[model samples]
Target chain A: MNRQIHLVERPKAAPTHEHFNLVETSIPKLGDQEVLIHNLYLSVDPYMRGRMSDAKSYVPPFKLNEKLVGGVVGEVVESNSDQFQTGDVVTGMLGWEEYSIAPEKEIRKVNPELAPVTTSLGILGLTGLTAYFGLIDICQPKEGETVVVSGAAGAVGSVVGQIAKIKGARVVGIAGSDEKIDYIKNELGFDEAINYKTTENIQEALEKACPNGVDAYFDNVGGEISDAVLNLLNKFARIAQCGAISSYNKVDDQGPRIQTKLIKSSALIKGFIVSDYAERFKEGAEQLGQWLQQGKLKYEETITEGFENIPDAFLGLFEGNNLGKQLVKIGEPQHAKL
Target chain B: MNRQIHLVERPKAAPTHEHFNLVETSIPKLGDQEVLIHNLYLSVDPYMRGRMSDAKSYVPPFKLNEKLVGGVVGEVVESNSDQFQTGDVVTGMLGWEEYSIAPEKEIRKVNPELAPVTTSLGILGLTGLTAYFGLIDICQPKEGETVVVSGAAGAVGSVVGQIAKIKGARVVGIAGSDEKIDYIKNELGFDEAINYKTTENIQEALEKACPNGVDAYFDNVGGEISDAVLNLLNKFARIAQCGAISSYNKVDDQGPRIQTKLIKSSALIKGFIVSDYAERFKEGAEQLGQWLQQGKLKYEETITEGFENIPDAFLGLFEGNNLGKQLVKIGEPQHAKL
Candidate 1:
């Protein structure tokens, strides 16, 4: 029997346990060109909150009473495909169950010698690529310029600040907790960090942090935080609107009109997802790996053990409970040796 | 003696007659490398509203008790430089006065034989160039894609719709009146027009008009109209934010937060002024001239007679009283032949 999590009901606001169900079922069988994967690590992200609602978005909403699918790192137990063999550790979009069956085209083998397998779902995978393309491609921060990143200690923002720093930019980060502030400022070498929860005046703190004015902004948590950053934009400032997790649970989020501000500064703001740069994934991954190997980049992960706690881990993202990439470590590979 | 208009006071809300003062003064004398200009046509624009307040913007705010300056078409009556001679009809940034003096480098000759000299203050000048660069360079509407233009009956917007049509895109115009709707649809050949004033449900009207989602939006009036348009953006949509006349007077303009919508659509929004494209003005002007000469493009002018009515013409823009470019015909050329 395999255990899996399913979306029992759609969420109108913040998701709770009632919206999801844990079911025990028979392991899915493999078909032609398909591999049976024993799940090892399951990834939970803020963007998944958007999929919980039946709204028209870039991707279709998660189906009710159906198994939730997301980034998964697993080892093949049985294979019927030439592309993948049994015992091969891989990463792909897979189910929340203990076992998942995926077509060979969907899963790609991960080399454990290069880095930890978990990095495949974090720094070396979609999260890293999101930070890379959204910052370099959209914001294009020049040397000596200031780059402000919201959600500073989250999966994507941590990498964004480091990359901006590598590009010789003054990096100022905005996060929720003092721990996050310390991590981003001291550990990640961010020029400054603001604890939005404690900061009485976010706009004033941002103005003090970014005295030269913000040249590039990587917005992961948009709301009043973004409103403050926008107020301090320099001429021709570029904003990479990567996420708006702040408003994902909000029904009627409103703020001051930004048109006049945009016009006054002649700024540019672009919204994007990682898939928008699908063709250049290899290039981005290669660069991020090089930065990691050179000790110029670093990443952290908060691993919550047990598959039953996956929902809690996902819910924690909204509360700013995780330090970096949030993942749930399930059963280890039975057939594959480390 | 010369007549001059001065910004006597800055208004906290909508500007009124008390904010301006008309005074009789001695005509300005030409210094070395300067020309004495007999003002003919003075352009009254929406952007001027931004200049009235003492706020930090692209250009400095209008000084109190000082003569107002704007785009002016005039005749050179006294030349003290090799760049100009007496009787040359020219256009440049000049004071809102019957007689003014400008440095030679600040003014350029306008050929009346090419078109009406007034065209220099309307279609063949900044207004035309604003529409050209904002639409082509920023929006870049593809063939068959839907292009929406707010403030569609006005100077910059009227030209934007025509250019989008010329680009083989389906053009949709949003205006404030039934007459403006008929003019944009029948006269300018826009595929659709929404009279925002009469329409009870702008979002529903827009949806009916644009079966396909909006791909490019040339936004000249930003407020609730923009909010409605933003809701219907297709993936990879582009918005050229040229103006926010709706909220220019409002001290605290508020609206629904757009970051989530921008992220969902993967759209791009850029704010700009015409002078931001100054380096490419020659290219824009030449293209506009060719289109005008070929009769592929057309323009209208709501010319208010007399220098005394200049303040009223400028104020009328906020009320949407002008159909196209609003200009005050202060005086005709004293020394140049029409």
Candidate 2:
């Protein structure tokens, strides 16, 4: 029997435990060119909040009473294809179940010896590549220019700040807590980190942090915090609209007015999902892998355990319970022989 | 004596006739590299509204009790440099006066035979270049794609729609009056036109006009209308943030929430001034001029007689009283021999 979670209802406000249900189901038998896998790690992401609403978006809404699915790293238990044999470690979109069945072409095998298997979901996965493309392609932070990132302690924002640093930019981060602030500033080598929860004037704090004025803004947390940063943008500033985690739960939320500043500064704002650069993913991952090997990039993950706790892991995202990448460890992966 | 207009007070809402004071003053003596000009036509643009406020913007605000300034087309009456001679038609940023003196290099000499002297202020000047860069560089409308333009009968929008049409795009224009709508569709060759003021549901009207969904949006009037357009944008749509004529008067106006639509569609919104493309001005102008000569572009101007009527011409922009370019004709240009 495979344990999995299902979306029982659409979320009206912030997603609650009632919205999801955990149940047991049988693992499907493998078909031709198909592989059966035992799931090891399941990834929870902020963008998934957008997928819960039945409104039009980049990705379709999750179906009610259907099995919830997302990025997962798993160990292939049985295979009927030449692409993979039992014991191969692979990652792809899969159900929250302990075991999943998929075609061999749907999963990409990763070398466990090259890096930790879980990095396929965090630093070296979609989260890190999102940072790489959103910053480098959209913002293109120049050397000595100031780059301010909101949700600075999150999986994506943390990597964005580090990449901005790697490119010799002045990095300033905004996070919800002091510990997240310290992690970004002290551990991640950020130039400055501001705990927005304690700051009286966010605009003033951002103004002081970016004395040269904000040349590029990687927005992960939108709302009042983004409004403050918009006020401090310099001429020709670039904004990478990554996520709006803060106001995602609000019904009919309106942020600040930007035309006054955006026009006056002749700025550029572009929104993108990581898949927009799917053709260039290999290039980005190679660069990120090289950076990790060279000790230029650092990352963290706040992981939970068990397949039954998937709903809790996903709920913790809305409450800001996790520090970095939020992952659920379901089982250990056995690497295939080199 | 030169007749000119001066800004008397900053307007709280819509600017009135009382906000402007007509004055007659002696023309200043010509200095080295100076040229005396007799203004032929003065442009009244929507962007000037931003400059009327004391607030910071792309251009500096108009000074209180000082001579108002904007784009002017004139003919040289006297020259103190080799760059110009008497009766040479030229265009530059100048005071709203019948006669004025400026350094020769500050004004560019344009040929009357190549196009009308007034074209320097409308089709062949800043107005045309604005539409060129804002459309081509920002939106990059592709063939067969739907391109929706707000303020469609205005100077810049008219040009923008025509350029999109020239690129083989399906053009839909949003204007205010039925007459303006007819003009854009019939005279300007727009595929469709929407009269936003009369429409009960703008989003529905836009939905009907753009059956395939909007692939590019050239925004002139911002606020609610733009919000409607934002709702209909398709995947990877581009938005040229040209002007927010609707909200220029409102204090701290919040246009619709773009973060939601922009993110879902992965759209791009860019705010720009014409001068931002100064280096590419030559290329943009050559293309515009070629289009005008080839009959691929058509334009209209609602010319108001007399130099004293500059304020009325400018005030009419907010009221949507004019079609295409609004120009105040001060005098006739004496063209220099070719």
Q: Largest TM-score belongs to which candidate? A: 1
Residue B217's lDDT in candidate 2: 90
Q: Write the per-residue lDDT of candidate 2 for residues B1-338, one digit (tens) a residue.
A: 88889999888777899889998889888999999998888999988878889775558899988789999988888999898989888889998988889998799988878888778888888899999999999999999999999999999999999999999999999999999999999999999999988999988889999999999999888888888888988999999888988788876676445676778899899999999999998998899999999999999999999877788889999999999999988886665543
lDDT score at residue B238, model 1, on the 0-100 scale: 99
lDDT of 2 at A206: 84
Model 2 chain A: lowest-lDDT 10 consecutive positions: A329-338
Measured by DockQ, the strongest candidate is: 1
User: What are the per-residue Cα lDDT tens digits for candidate 2 across A1-338?
Assistant: 88889999999889998999988888877899999998899999989888889987768899999888899998888999899989899899998888899998889997889998889999999999999999999999999999999889999999999999999999999998989999999999999999998999887888889888999999987788888888887889999998988778988778556765778889989999999999999999999999999999989999999877888999888777889899999986654543
Q: Which runs in model 1 stand beyond 4 Å of their true positions? A: none
Chain B TM-score for all candidates, comma-separated:
0.98, 0.97
* lDDT score for residue B300 of model 2: 94
| Model 2 chain B lowest lDDT segment of ten | B329-338
Query: Which 10 residues in a row give candidate 1 chain A its minimum summed lDDT?
Result: A329-338
Instruction: TM-score each candidate.
Output: 0.99, 0.97
Model 1 iRMS (Å) reads: 0.7
